[model samples]
Target: MSFDIPDDRQYLESHEWALETDGVVRVGITDFAQDELGDVVFVELPGEGDHLKQEDDLGVIESIKAVSDLYAPVSGEVTAVNEALFDAPELVNEDPFGEGWMLEIDADDTAELEALLTAEAYEDQIA
Candidate 1:
């Protein structure tokens, strides 16, 4: 199967993607991740006030295939979360980059973004 690796976003080897806008960054699993997980049934996200450390567990994603830990790509406070996922976890499968985005972070350090892979590199990594 094919996958989308958006050029505008930074990707983790673990398959999460981060997109920065202004000072805040949006975080979510990549299409490759969701597809591999299959039919996401539930998503447990960090609360708005929670702090996440890079490479630490951020939350859980449950799918028909298996449950997996979602990890943090950067250290930051969760400024907001996607309330929509609570009602429709399948959004992760349907639109992994758009409405399926898990949360927003007020990044403690944007320099960490440079450490993430470019879309091309991620595609090769997945391949």
Candidate 2:
């Protein structure tokens, strides 16, 4: 099996992906994660301005097969939430990296991203 692991972002062993740009980090689940979960039915996410610690519970993603907890890959204040998911959760299955992005956070420490896995390493992990 193969998965889409973009080199532009960092990944957690738990399957969250984080892409940082100008101090803000966008987060979402990986394609492999969505695939394993089956079709996403709903997503529960933190509101804007919510503060989160690294590894904190970010939210829940419900799929036909299972419910999964999403974790914060970096500590920070949530800057935005993808409201679109509430209406069309299937976006997670169609575009895990783009329109399916869960949230964006103003990271407390951008350097923290360095601790995450690279695309190559993440690919190896799911392999």
Candidate 3:
């Protein structure tokens, strides 16, 4: 199946994606990732106000296939976590980039977003 790699976002080799808007960085697993993981069963996310560094483990995503780490794409304080996922983790598979977003961070440096891989680069990696 083809995956959606949005041009507006940045991605990591490990399959996390980040989108920067209004100085906030929103993070989630890529479509390729959720597909590979099978059905999501649980999510462990950081609380709001938690601090993180670039590449730090921000949370865990558990699936029938495996349990994977969710990393921070940029250093910052977490402004929000998708608390809804705690109740309905299947959303991670259903709408990963939208209502399924894992967290929003107030980025420490906007330039970090530029250092990330483009959607094409990410697609190449997964391909």
Candidate 4:
């Protein structure tokens, strides 16, 4: 399956994406990524206060078909995890860019965000 890259976010080659706002960065799997994973069954996420570097593995997301690593899109300490996903993993498949966001981080590199792909670039990447 293929999914459209949203213009509102910055994308990584590994399929994670981040939305920068104020001092916080919201992280999640891209639509293309969740489509590849099929039906999500579980998501194991980091706790608040956990520190992560850019490109670091932060947690795991399990689909009905496979398990995928969730990477940090930027360096930061985790501020919150989406508690709703604990019960409804399909939230990732149903609405990845909205309620399916994995966590919010207290961001460390705002300008470094420029390194990520734009929506056009991300779509090109999968093509």
Candidate 5:
């Protein structure tokens, strides 16, 4: 099966994607992840100002088929959360990369993003 793995971001083996602009990194699940999760029913996310470590438990994403834990892609303070997910969880399924973005963090170390997978590497991993 094929998945949408955008070139502009880095990815985790666990299926989270991170796109850094300036010092902030926006995060969300990969399209393959959402497809596997089925219809997203609920999302639990950290609030603004919450500090997180890379790989920390950021929140939960509940889908019709299973509940999954979302991990932090980069360590830092959460700057924003997608409140739209609370009201329309299906956005996760509909647009995992855009309007479905889960959060944005002011990265503690922007260099950390270098450790993440490139779109080609991620596509290979999922393949």
Candidate 6:
């Protein structure tokens, strides 16, 4: 269950991560999640500009194995969604942290990111 998490990002117990850039936080499912879920078949994403609370169910990702909810890592208003996922959901299983990113939000509070798990902590759980 061990996985490598990028030092530059913060992770959630739900197997999501937040990558902050210029006040906006990019969100995506972890590699472990995609691997467990098998091939991604579809994605249901929140619309741009939609306000969300921390831990809110922002979307659903359908995979060959099962459907999993995608939550907001922190409270914010969604600024963008990866529209490409609509046409090519497999990218989630192929390159989860790269082209598989789900959405970006203008973060409401930077401190919210602190509540997430560190890479070591995340690995411990899945291990």
For 10-116, candidate 1 gives per-residue lDDT tens digits of 99998999999986989999999999999999999999999998888999999999999998888999999999999999999999999999999999998999999
How far is 55's C-alpha from truth in model 2 (Å)? 0.6
TM-score of each: 0.98, 0.98, 0.98, 0.95, 0.98, 0.96
**49, model 2: CA deviation in Å?**
0.6
What tens-digit string does per-residue lDDT give for candidate 3 at 11-124? 988899999999899999988999999999999999999999999998899999899988899999999989999999999899988888999999999898887899999988
lDDT of 1: 0.94
Clash tally, candidates in order? 0, 0, 0, 0, 0, 0
Model 1, position 114: C-alpha lDDT score: 93
Each model's lDDT comes to 0.94, 0.96, 0.92, 0.90, 0.96, 0.91
Best-to-worst order by lDDT is 2, 5, 1, 3, 6, 4
lDDT of 4 at 13: 92
In terms of lDDT, the poorest run of 10 residues in model 5 is 1-10
lDDT of 2 by residue, 40-104 (tens): 99999999999999899999999999999999999999999999999999999999999999999
Tens-digit lDDT track for model 6 on 2-113?
5657778989899998999988999999989998999999999999999999999999999888999988998999999999999999998888889999999999997899
Q: lDDT per residue, candidate 5, 3-86, as tens digits? A: 899999999999999999999999999999999999999999999999999999999999989999999999999999999999
Candidate 3 residue spans exceeding 4 A from truth: none
Who is ahead in TM-score, 4 or 5? 5
Listed per candidate, the RMSD to the true structure in angstroms reads: 0.7, 0.5, 0.7, 1.2, 0.5, 1.0
Task: State which candidate, 1 or 5, has the greater lDDT.
Answer: 5
The C-alpha stretches of model 5 lying farther than 4 A from their native spots are: none
